[model samples]
Target: MEARLDLAGSPVAGKALKHFIAANTALAGSTLPRATRELVEIRASQINGCGFCVDMHTKDAAHAGESALRLNLVAAWREATVFTEAERAALELAEQGTRIADAGGGVTDEAWAKAAEHYDEDQLAALVSLIALINAFNRLNVIVRRPAGDYRPGQFD
Candidate 1:
């Protein structure tokens, strides 16, 4: 299916995305582990039902040496045993952060505490920013019905 609009072709969307990409580029230097970052992105995308992001981040994660098993298990991360404790913490935070409106409390104190146990202040900052950013991207893509499966790793770089 075609997207409702070509985001890259629209000046308004394009300008906003350019800044978004720039922000992400800056966030890429965060101390959060690359593997965890990808996992968080994938998990948030999965929760948001943004196929384009899932496809892109999964492929990008694979290219960056994440195992197929781990990638496959991200959706079932709670039930899967392949992830590190830190990864699991981040995933839990991502889920809670992504589904903020689903729960009356937004994010639970327990989830935040768990994440804080695993991440330093800088890493937590990055995680919070990443979660918010990915959710924004997911909403835009899902709203536009952006088709998935054609993304090449680093295609935008």
Candidate 2:
């Protein structure tokens, strides 16, 4: 399958994505744990049905030493025992944030509080930005029907 457009080749999309990538790089330096970041990205992509992102993040997670079991269980994280409390809280936030329209009011206070218990202010900022960034990428990929399963770890970096 072919993407409807090559995002990197389009000046408009390219400019926007450059800023997006810069934002992501800044977020990457935040105190949010790298493992949690990947899990949250994967979970949000899963919810959004963005196969391209799911493939990219899953591979990236694996390359970063995330266990296969944990990767496979991200979708069912609520029922899984492999996640830490902090990771669980992040996952809850990611879900609520990604499904904002379905929930009608966006991320709940309870979810935010739970995440707050685990993250510092800077970490929270990164977590929020990562959620938004991943969702934007998800929508772009989903809309283009980007094919999956060919991504390599660190392909973008």
Candidate 3:
């Protein structure tokens, strides 16, 4: 139940986290829709089995008014009727981004084009950066075996 290391207590990780927080602030202000952002974050976390991120993002999304149905159905998003095309595209990109090793070629042209159909250039940039950032957070938490279910909305803020 204990994390292997305290990321906040380590000077190296603390500095990295500061810049990460700043980068996230910049991404938050991007043109990507707030709901889609949360969805992508949660979906990627779930795929990576990063319980800390799943708890954090789900709480944050709910605090921002994301419906419980959508949150519960992120793993089954393809079959769910609760999402828009834009949201679907974002989720597809997140899946591809998170499962790069499985796919063997990273994100495919089809997924990228599907995502491009919905998001503008800036939003696409944000989505790509968000995927990378969330994966980084997921890997850090998963490798450290961070426990879940205790996160509060805005805990990081």
Candidate 4:
């Protein structure tokens, strides 16, 4: 498969993506745990069928020592036992946030309350921003038909 456009080669895309990439960099310094952030990204990418992102995040998470068991279970986290309550809360929020179009009311109050229970305000802010960020990345990659399975860990870094 081939991408519709070369985001790296296109000055217009590069200009737009620079800000998105910067936002992601800032979120990396936030209070949200790296593992949790990767899990959220992976789950959102999966929901969006963005294989390039799924490939990128899964490899990055594994490179950072995320267990294969946990990584594989991200798609089925509700039935998995490898995650903590906090991680579960973040995943739930990611799912709800990513599927907002499917849910009429956006994220449910219960989901937000649960996430709030597990995360401080700053952490919650990071989680929210991460969700939005990953969804944007997913849309970009999916829209362009970016191929998967060639990503290297730290390739973007």
What TM-score against the true fold does each predicted structure earn?
A: 0.98, 0.98, 0.98, 0.98
**Local distance difference test, each candidate:** 0.94, 0.95, 0.94, 0.95
Residue pairs in collision within model 3 = none
lDDT (0-100) at residue 123 of candidate 1?
96
Write down the lDDT that model 4 would get.
Answer: 0.95
lDDT (tens digit, per residue) of candidate 3 on 23-142: 989999998999999999999999999999999999999999999999999999999999999999999999999999998889999999999999999999999999999999999899
Model 4 C-alpha lDDT per residue in residues 67-152, reported as the tens digit of each score: 99999999999999999999999999999999998979799999999999989999999999999999999999998899999999
Q: How many residue pairs clash in each candidate?
A: 0, 0, 0, 0
The TM-score of candidate 1 is 0.98
Candidate 1: global Cα-lDDT? 0.94
Give the Å error, residue 79, model 2. 0.4
Per-model root-mean-square deviation over C-alphas: 0.7, 0.8, 0.7, 0.7
Off by over 4 Å in 1: none
In the predicted model 1, the residue pairs found to clash are none
